[model samples]
Target: MKRPNFIVIMTDQQRWDHLGCYGNPVLRTPNIDAIAAAGQRLDRFYVANPICQPNRACLATGQLSTVNGCRQNGIPLSPGQVTYAEVLRAAGWRTALIGKAHFQNVTDVPAPSRQAAGKGDDLPASVALARREQRDGPDYLNEVRAAWAANPDRTVPLPYYGFEYLRLCIGHGDQVEGHYSRWLRDRCPEAVDLRGPDHALDDPAVRVAQCWQTALPEDCYPTAYVAEEAEAYLRSCRADEPFLLVLSFPDPHHPFTPPGRYWDLYDPAEVELPASFGDAVNRRNDLPDALRQAYRMGDEDPHSYWPFHLFEPELRRIIALNYGAITMVDDAVGRVMRTLSEVGLDDDTVVCFTSDHGDYMGDHGTVLKMGLHYQSVIRVPFLWRDTAQRRQPGVSRVQASAIDFAPTILQRAGLRVPVGMQGEDIFAAPPDRPVLIEDPGIGVFRDPDSRSALISLVHDDWRLSLLEGCMDWGELYDLGADPNETTNLWFDPEVAGRKTELLLRLAERQLALRDLSLCPTARA
Candidate 1:
């Protein structure tokens, strides 16, 4: 039997409920919906961290953030970490990455020379800054690439953690950089730089609370660009060779900018806010004073946090734009799926779609995610389709996560699961393991504070969260009763027993999950 070709499609900051198939009443995501209809969509899928880099590192290496040392956004994956791409490549599978690849650090970025100089170099700030500004490499975010594009070595990265070839799109929104920027450079120059993280172009339609439409045509959007690249790869590759291609879309994230026609695809005035929107019950005044001070939630980031007291209308527009971004991604997926079928690679390929994490999407008056562990932020849509076999499509309520991806892909490819991996195989059928979600730090996991950490466990329809070293006022949710997570049962005496049981489980999981992959028998 031939190995199955794998294509994993991922979106940035898209919530589980944003899809038409996932009970999203407003959006039309037929391509993504079709994938679920044809394959198995996990009812309870999640991410180890709600942020980008850490979760991506988790997906790539099949290990938790702590194990890989990329606990938050700014920390880069250690070059020593082994990823599924390397394992598959070693097994004779060709691998490539398109669009966002947030596996590296964005702050205090190292130059190629400095990276080669090894970790302990104590260079002055000026020299290090100069070197990093000149470097590019495989930065997963466009902002990072643009910041370090001067270093010619960035174009020729030192080694990608595991991927053999990567065509990185480092920016989000109108801030498209790297190969994506070049694609738009002369082709659609007018729309390319309409807006960016630092500069906003003079377009009225492109202003929706960090959300906007660009002058770029729908076909030239980054979402579409990614599909084009992936399609080209599929057509160029030999049909007999197995390959791993990850098409990562960097939209539906912050700066809420969906380019071209997608910006107006959904009407903001007609868009309804989440059912739990503005429920003060979502507030975290319950946390310890220290944690509360550290993560002010709605008070931290002004761009993403628009108070109804002054900007209720803005939030609605953002939601519409968020959905618009998702819709565009859906269309892109549909395009690629068609290309796969056109090239006759559909039957031999396995397709999996998911997000790095979920977004708040205006739930409880929040636009994006942070330290909150509500279902809106923790639960993500995970769907898989194996076209090689024909079966009734179904939804599996398995407790799984981004970490499980690498192991599953390896399993699907018939490659040996590496001993160094900590993620579970997707088909192993482990019994009732609680989903563990960790928030490694403040800002750049980018939160409001750097002094706190959050860990959550979801098991048996209950979710429990604790602040590291501070437990007086952590959060507990009876997801069965309050599916919207409108109520936090932390102090409710009626649920004390439930809380105790979950706490014990969380502790046990923590003790068990700490890096323990060393093979003693193989050692002398």
Candidate 2:
């Protein structure tokens, strides 16, 4: 019997409910839906954090942001950390990563957190170590677009974060540049003129922010490039060798540019706004100042990466374009899956589909993501299809986080999971534990008195979040009673007792997940 091959198809900024199988009535995702139909669909699967780099780092390391030290978007995953891909590669599996690998910072911008702080002796020793330590190397610049733009021939060093071969798409939407950019320029030199909002089709009807009708054809888009490369890799695979290939799509994220027919697959007029959209906009005064600022932004689309408020009509346009991008990704997925079957590796390969994080997508009147942990931003689709496992095919509401992905994949591949990985083998037993989400916010929360660092615990039907750097305000929600999170029960005295209990659990969970990989050889 041969070890099973792995194909992890990940999409950027896609929420759980955006898929047809996930109860999305508007999006046509027959291919992704087919994967769900044949596999176990995890209903409550959440990201370790709501941001990109941190959660992706958690996925690769099987550890939380605090343990892995990638607490925000600009922070690169430490080169010292071990990834499951490295484990599989070490075991003689041919490892390849195609499309978006955001393991490193995409831009050359310095993080605000790295700014010099005021001199303070009150800070703990751990904070001193973390703040002063230089854990990354010069290779950290491998993913920066400026570096690539300066030298198009440069590529990431081999075995990057465990991937032996990487076909990287550095940024999101059509503007993405990396190996994909070089390939696109070579394949179609004219594609350069067709990229970005400046070259968008003349469509005044769509007034959504960060959305443009790309002039590039469907085949020339990043999503199509990823599928084509993945197909080529599958075709090149030898029968005697097992491989792990990641088809990561940089679509369905920001600056929605679905090329060709994908741009108009869904009509913005027909798109439906989220249930909480109306309430959020109408009752902005009732929300915390931190959250209400989004609603006050009105019609202006700053086009900045941070979440911004949008009117119902503008949000509808975003949804429509987002749907178009998603459908394009679905088509690409269909192509890859068909290639798997064509190469006769369908039955032997484990196909898993998930996303790094999710977009706000009109949830609470916000468009992008940051400083918020609504289900719209945190919960994402997780589909697992393995032929060797006898696990019944059905929806598993058992909560799981991005950290669990690494351990689960390693266990399924019959590899020994590293002792340092904090996540459980979700397949061996239900991870009937609370999911912890950590986010060191990037100034998205505009409140001066509030610090943006957040720690949330999701268990059963209750969600509790503690906003660090400030003690006066926090969030507590009864997800069972209010799935839309319209009400924050943090101030409700009736739930005071329950909130205390959950806080204690959150503390215990945080301690439990601390890095125990380093054992002291000497007690002194």
Candidate 3:
């Protein structure tokens, strides 16, 4: 029998609630909705980390961030770790990665972090002035300074892991086009001039437009581009050999800048705000000041700001825009799915859809993925479409994490999971298995002090969070009664026994998963 082909489509920072199938009425995600309708959608799915690179690294290695050596965004996955692609390659399946794979660190030529750290206030006036400039400032001087300060040793010619074909962005959202532009300009100085009126340095818009033209075709936005490349690879696959294609898209992440058409697809007035929108829950103790600020900003203007604060009306608009982006991705996915059907490969293909992490679109007054354990940031959309089996379409309330994806995919492909893999194949496990999630610090570039690490264990009714350090403030919500997690039960003395029981259970769950680093602290 021919091994089934695998097509894994991953989006950047998409929230589960952004999908029409997930109950967003304004979302125009017909293609994704169709997939959910045909396949089992895991409603209680989650990611190991709320950040990008660490989560992607977990998906790649089937291990949590700590074990994979990619604990944060800037950190790269250790070269020694075994990847899902390697497993597929061993099974004689052709493997390819297209679009944003944040498996590697940003390649800094002069080491920006180093320069910024060492230069102090007395550094060259150009560098100092560059640091003071706003991200969207008039001059590209700051950008130039950043380029000079970046670590020169980090550049890799190709994508990380064993992907045979790659069209990927090296860093985060805004820098995606810029990275490629610098590379092209450096390699072909004469082919593309970087000076004078035509140069990108003169105008930032020109830089973006030029990068769009030079790096890819007109229809090739990140999401669409990855799908197109994956389709081409699928078409090129020979029947004698199975293939594994990973299509990763950088969308719905930041800059929220989908094309104007996508933005215009949804009416802001029609978009409904979330139930927890604008309401500050447990702010006295459970919420931090930084988080409050983010929520305020996100609620005020999610589109314009970098670090968003959760606001109800503004969050509605943001969600609407996010829904539009999801629709765009869904359309791209539809094309890929259609290509598979056209090639008669649908029956033998296993297509999985998920994201690196989720966005906190006004959930708990936070905008982006940051903070302790929250449903918005931790819970992600997970769907597995197995064409070989005629399984009933339904929703699974089982707690699923991003770590489970790699092992599950490998198992479905008849490949062995690596010895150190911490996740189990959800399909093979009993439906009642408890779901565990870990939060290993936050803020990609900043120190870990800004955020606290947490470990959450979710069973049928209770959701418990174990704070790693001295956080006098904590949260415990009975998800069954309060699905929105608006109330904090941690301070309720009446539920002390329940909290104790859940904490023990949380520890046991962690230990069972071989995560011995967790320790329970007494409630303050």
Candidate 4:
């Protein structure tokens, strides 16, 4: 039998609640919604890290961010790291990456993490977050430009981490660069400039990074670029050759610039504030004093959003823009799905759509993301559309993460999984698996005393966040009772026993997650 083809469509900073299939009432994501309707959607899906590079690294290597060695945004996956692409290729799969890949450190001269991604004990939280070492690292645009000038038509950009072919796109929003920049220039040179400055949005109160419609034509948006490239790759695939393609989209992220009519898709008045934001979340506040202090800008605006003086109404507008961006992505997804059928590869392909992580998106009054372990930032959408699996279409409450992504894909392709892979097969995925989430915070916690390295565990109905040394101040949420995660129960006397039990559970879970056993024990 011919091995199955694979496609993993990933978006940046998209929340699980943003999709129509995910119980989102307002957003119309027909293509993605249909994909979920075809197979099983894991409802409790999450990422090991709430940020980009780390979890993307996990998906690439099938290991936790701490273990894979790219735990934070600035750190690059080690060159010695054996990504699943390499394994799948060795297992007789042709692979290509076509879009944003934060796998490499994105530097001309790569910086190897001395320790694995989030395993740096000697590093201070500020140091880890600040990325002081990368201050003078080669500018990404100049490096990509010079590299392309020197080596025209380089098959894979910077060896593409592990992909055999890459049409790499870097930068997000109107600030697009790399191969995508060139592609946009070719199609819509003016798109390279965008609708204009955020000030052009005409709302004096609107921040540059807040919701806005760009002057650039919708056809030339990055979402369109990725969709076109994915179809091109699908069309180019040989008739009998099996392939693995990762088309990562960098949108619904920030600089909330949706192109053309998508900008008008949602009205700001229709946007609703999350129940956990402001007084609502604070009324039953379980946020650690330290976490609260971190969020306390004290009359100053948090840099999470532009203009920073965000009121409830302004946040709603931002949410509306975020919805628009999701719609735009949905349209791109529709085009790619149509092309998959057009190329006659739809039936044999195993397609999964997810995101690097979820965005705050006005949840808890934040815009994008921080190291927070709230469902808004850590919980992402995971859908598997496998032609081989003929199960009743529905949502599975199984806890899933990017760690399982590679093994799941390889399993669908009928390829042997590497013994070193630390994820379960999706076909037999553990419904009660304790999903581990890691966040190597980007510089300075809300409280100066807090640890920068955060480890969160989503086991069953409880989500616990363990601070790297400050154990007492860590967060524990009874997600069963407060699914919105409005209350932090870390120091609550009522749950002291529960917290202790969870601590022990976390200890055991950590051992399981940290185990690097590459082979079964052989007794002679």
Which candidate number would show the highest lDDT if scored against the true structure? Answer: 2
Q: Give model 1's TM-score versus the native structure.
A: 0.87
Output the lDDT of residue 100, model 2.
85
* Candidate 4 lDDT, 348-451, residue by residue in tens: 88888999888776666666676467888888998888765443578888788888888887776677777677887866876887888877653332323335
**Candidate 4 residue 336 C-alpha distance from true site, Å:** 1.0
Worst 10 residues of 1 by lDDT: 302-311
Residue 209 shift from truth in candidate 4, angstroms: 4.4
List ranges where model 3 is wrong by over 4 Å.
Answer: 107-159, 171-175, 178-220, 282-307, 310-313, 448-451, 515-524
Task: Note each model's CA RMSD in angstroms.
Answer: 5.4, 3.1, 9.0, 5.3
Candidate 2 ranges beyond 4 A from true positions: 112-132, 135-137, 203-206, 281-301, 388-391, 444-450, 522-524
Local distance difference test, each candidate: 0.76, 0.83, 0.66, 0.73
Candidate 3, 1-524: lDDT as tens digits: 56888888888888887787788766778888877888889998878777787888888887887677677655566556788888888778888877676665444332234233453356765664443422222221222324422532233343247666655544333234323444433444442342222332223452311111122222534455567667888889876778888877777776554553665477767877667765666254446554444444434554433345544555556666676667778889899999988888887888788888887676755567666567777778888778667545888876777788889988887777777788879778666666677666533244433455666777766677765554565567898898888777988998888888887887776777774323456774
- Model 2's alpha-carbon lDDT is 0.83
- What's the best-to-worst order under TM-score? 2, 1, 4, 3
Model 4 backbone overlap count: 7
TM-score of each: 0.87, 0.93, 0.79, 0.85
**lDDT (Cα, tens digit) per residue for candidate 2, span 1-524:** 68889999999999789999999878899999999888999999999999888899999999988888887776689878999999999998999999888888888765433322577555665574445655455778888877765566776789888999889888888888888878887888898788888877857465467888888888888898999999999999976899999999998999888888887789888887888886653244544554444434433445767777778777887899899999989989999999999998888889999999998888877788875688999999999988645435788878899999999999988888897899987776565689999987644433222355778999878899977555787889899999998888998999999999999999998888988767688977
- Please provide, for model 1 over 64-98, each residue's C-alpha lDDT reduced to its tens digit, 9 standing for 90 to 100: 98887778766677666789998988888888898
